[model samples]
Target: MLSDTHPAGPGAAMRSDEDFVRAQTGIAPVPFVPEVRLHMAEDAIALWETTETARGERGLPPPFWAFAWAGGVGVARYVLDHPELVAGRSVLDLAAGSGLVGIAAALRGARSVRAAEIDAYAVAAIGVNAAANGVRVDAAVEDLLDGDGGPAEVVLAGDVFYERAMAARFLPFLLRARARGAVVIVGDPGRAYLPRERFAALAAYEVPVVADLEDAALKTTTVWELAGD
Candidate 1:
């Protein structure tokens, strides 16, 4: 959702995370995924600045957890419409900014859902967002990319191929999962690093996004499945 270049930067290890999210955002439904509601900020830059001041820190990763990204929204739409792909399966939302995709899986009746983020604050926001959407999503501050294939049958990753280092690490992890018989899917708004040739498009959507964050009112996002070798 956010530009990978955005210099950014949470809470307790939950309560304070919720408190901070509440203090910084307003509850609203994502325009494209109205089935879910999230605490969001209107101005991405302003919110990031305020977050820095509130936490008395600088150089924090952007408040990516505060907003719904176009990619995540698109992937969620596809999953909701194609419930059979995720229903009754174990799902993992890797690099889950707000746990949108994982929540969608849960809402679609996935047997279990885990949403992972490297940021602790985002981890907390995930919990709050999951509760608001009335879905039970397990939140963890983890680097799922650091391991071999996980146990989840389906893995949903949003906008992860924007940066070279991350993309490099993420793609191989996804391949490992695919090799293990996991269904790996990704939602990307054509980020620079997406390895298009390796994935097959499943769906596309014109996702509404914050102009401040995306520099455009809408972005065409695509859901792509990693091909198994």
Candidate 2:
């Protein structure tokens, strides 16, 4: 199981729009700003882009991906570095936070892309951002581990190894997908649950992340990828 020192408790599960907003801008770290390009998915759920001021002290802020989380950065870097991997394949982006990876796949010419996420707000955010980017993707509010996934030639997972419960639920599914002849790729930056032996390193990058939400601009995060065992 994965483990982390980050607290998880009441009001922990993004309960309010304010919480979402606070997450986006109140904690701006000095972003490393990679040159990775993205292609938005049209069929993905769409949510308005919200900023600290635009939220007006109410409504939800954008999701983690909107600001480009660590995992997203790593995946984006991989796609930009190796565009040919997705040029003509069907892709499944699991735990599709902000739908960035999936969008990248579509942008790179994937025949089809699906962004699967369980959070309604995240799903909506993905749809909105996907439209903004002008790509086509199917968005579904389902967990692949819950037996809700469909067949795809490739699967993308980003930063999902932070929580033990999540890792437990997700790893087996990824292994299963691998056994089924699908390419399973995960971008992680030393998350506790990442099974080093089960994957082969593909790439690495230094991504900026908020070390302290209150202090925002003081941290640099390292990100990496595991393409296969």
**lDDT (Cα, tens digit) per residue for candidate 1, span 1-229:** 2223233332232566667788888888888999888888888889889878766678988988989998899999999999999999999899898888888899999999988898867887888888988989998888878674489999899889889998999999999999999999999997999999999999999999988889899999999999987
Off by over 4 Å in 2: 1-66, 213-229
lDDT per residue as tens, model 2, 33-147? 3333322222111334343343343345334444456776677567756878788999888888667788778878899999988655566556655565678878766767955
Error of 2 at 127 (Å): 1.1
For each candidate, the alpha-carbon lDDT, in order, equals 0.86, 0.62
Error of 2 at 189 (Å): 1.2
Indicate the TM-score of model 2.
Answer: 0.69
TM-score of the candidate numbered 1? 0.92
- Ten contiguous residues with the weakest lDDT in model 1: 1-10
**Relative to the unseen true structure, what is the Cα RMSD of model 1?**
5.1
